[model samples]
Target: DQQVKQNSPSLSVQEGRISILNCDYTNSMFDYFLWYKKYPAEGPTFLISISSIKDKNEDGRFTVFLNKSAKHLSLHIVPSQPGDSAVYFCAAPFLTGNQFYFGTGTSLTVIP
Candidate 1:
């Protein structure tokens, strides 16, 4: 019943190391990829995004990589920090429908 899902439900990374979060979607026509970070008692915040045409998008320490042919999405965080510890979700809205697919959140723990 889920179109987008994270490879793992959780991840742990040492501080200052690169943390790679992976997501896969079943929809082949997905045009946009979105990464959101959420903390306790708060709504998901948009962290970064990329269009299907672009293979990669970077913003500061966060980078999103998209592989259309593989229907894969990845969020890379360089120099992971404790403050970066949170639940991350990958989402994409159907280009022609009202449905939006969201990945089962991946809880990331950036160990200090």
Candidate 2:
């Protein structure tokens, strides 16, 4: 099964706090990992990504950690903001240019 699981359907945090989003995958062949942020009807924007060769990737307030052995990954948002209040999706691609499989998505709310 091409199941990438996001256990939590929602999360809430205060501004300037840390927001953690978790994801897991069942397929061992997935080599590239990506995190996207979605707001309502718009498409998800690429937030950060890591390859099978790397264990972690960071970009400004966002960071993604991969544990190949556990088939798991997580996204951490430092100093979470109201702008960060949106749905996040974790996707894995089988190969370059291939369609990606998505998790159910995590809706995050950041209070002022």
Candidate 3:
């Protein structure tokens, strides 16, 4: 079974709106969570992250929220723009620290 999962395969939002992406993990040992954005043929760029100890972390237009008790986390983008269209992935390193687990990813499209 997959350790991390993105329940939504894709999401579309109008420009200047909010885009919400959700992810779930089965591991309680995941101490840190990160969100990454990827464009076609390009590598994923780190967006934002929240530690298990933190309930929320925000960076400019992006924010990541973690609910450790529920083993869930979410990414929120404000004023979504066409340029923001990309695949977003949630990831965390395993307890061993040598390996990491990533969600399948959720494709986000911001319509102009």
Candidate 4:
């Protein structure tokens, strides 16, 4: 079974604080990992990604770490902002072209 699990369905943090989102997967074939941020009524936008060959990737205030041996991954946001309040989805590339497997989602709320 292909299950990308985001056990915690939501998280809340105050502005200018750090926010961490977690994800786990059982499939080992997934080599490309990605994090997407979604706003209400809008499609998810790619945040960051790391190849299975790499353990960590970072972009500005967003960072993603992949632990292939443990089959786990996480997204970290430094100094979370009110504008960062939205749903985050973790995904991995599927064997099929242009296909992806996604976690249910985690809603992050940043208090102003």
Candidate 5:
């Protein structure tokens, strides 16, 4: 079974709107959560992260929310732009091991 999963395979939003992506994990010991955005033929770049101690973290138009009890998290992008279109992935570092768990990723398209 996958430790981290992205429930939505794709999402579409109009420009200047909000784009929300959801993620879930089965592991309870994950302490660090990260979101990455990737363009075609390139490696993913880190966007935002939230520690387990905090429920929310934000950077400009990107925000991440963590719900430890539910083992769930979500990424929110406000005023979504056409340039924001990409594959967004959520990842969690394992507490007991060096390996990391990553979600399948959600493809987001911001329509002009």
Candidate 6:
């Protein structure tokens, strides 16, 4: 079972435009970043969430940035595509650093 459910809220972006998704954290113990993307008929898979120590990480058209001082995280998708349409989730690890606390996801729709 998925750890979190997607909220009714959603985001719609035009294809080939920049799509920015943001997340914020209040816990200082959050050392590592965790983001997941879920597609229809598939389980949520790890996307990109670099460690808090690192400011940014990128994979192809997707980029993730972490701001430790501000306790904020952002994922940037350049040239967004229809294939990128999915539910994106943000997660933080527990104090014990064993399990993770997942946030209600944000549904993203890419307008082709």
What are the per-model C-alpha RMSD values against the true structure? 1.1, 1.2, 0.8, 1.1, 1.0, 3.5
lDDT of 4 at 96: 78
Best by lDDT: 5
State the RMSD for candidate 4.
1.1
| Predictions in order: lDDT | 0.94, 0.94, 0.93, 0.93, 0.95, 0.83
lDDT of 5 by residue, 19-98 (tens): 99999999898899999999999999999999999999999999999999999999999999999999999999886658
* Model 6 lDDT tens row, 2-63: 43323445899999999888787777778887889999899999988788768999999989
Q: Write the per-residue lDDT of candidate 4 for residues 1-112, one digit (tens) a residue.
A: 6479898999999999999999999988899888999999999998999999999998999989999999999999998999999999999888874888899999999999
Q: Mark the regions of model 6 whose C-alpha exceeds 4 Å error after superposition.
A: 1-8
Quickly count the clashes in candidate 3. Answer: 0
> For model 5, what is the alpha-carbon lDDT of residue 32?
93
**Model 2 residue pairs with clashes:** none
Query: Candidate 4, residue 64: CA error in Å?
Result: 0.2
List of clashing residue pairs for candidate 3: none
- Each candidate's TM vs. the true structure? 0.96, 0.94, 0.97, 0.94, 0.96, 0.87
Query: What are the runs in model 1 whose C-alpha is more than 4 Å off?
Result: none
Q: Report the Cα lDDT for candidate 5.
A: 0.95
Clash number by candidate, in order: 0, 0, 0, 0, 0, 0
Clash count for candidate 4 is 0
- Give stretches of model 4 more than 4 Å off: none
Q: Any idea how many clashes model 5 has? A: 0
Taking the tens digit of each residue's C-alpha lDDT, what string does model 3 give over 1-112? 8999999999999999999999999978889988999999999999898888789999999989888889999999998999999999999988677898999999999999
User: Which of the two candidates, 1 or 3, achieves a greater TM-score against the reference?
Assistant: 3
Task: Mark the regions of model 2 whose C-alpha exceeds 4 Å error after superposition.
Answer: none
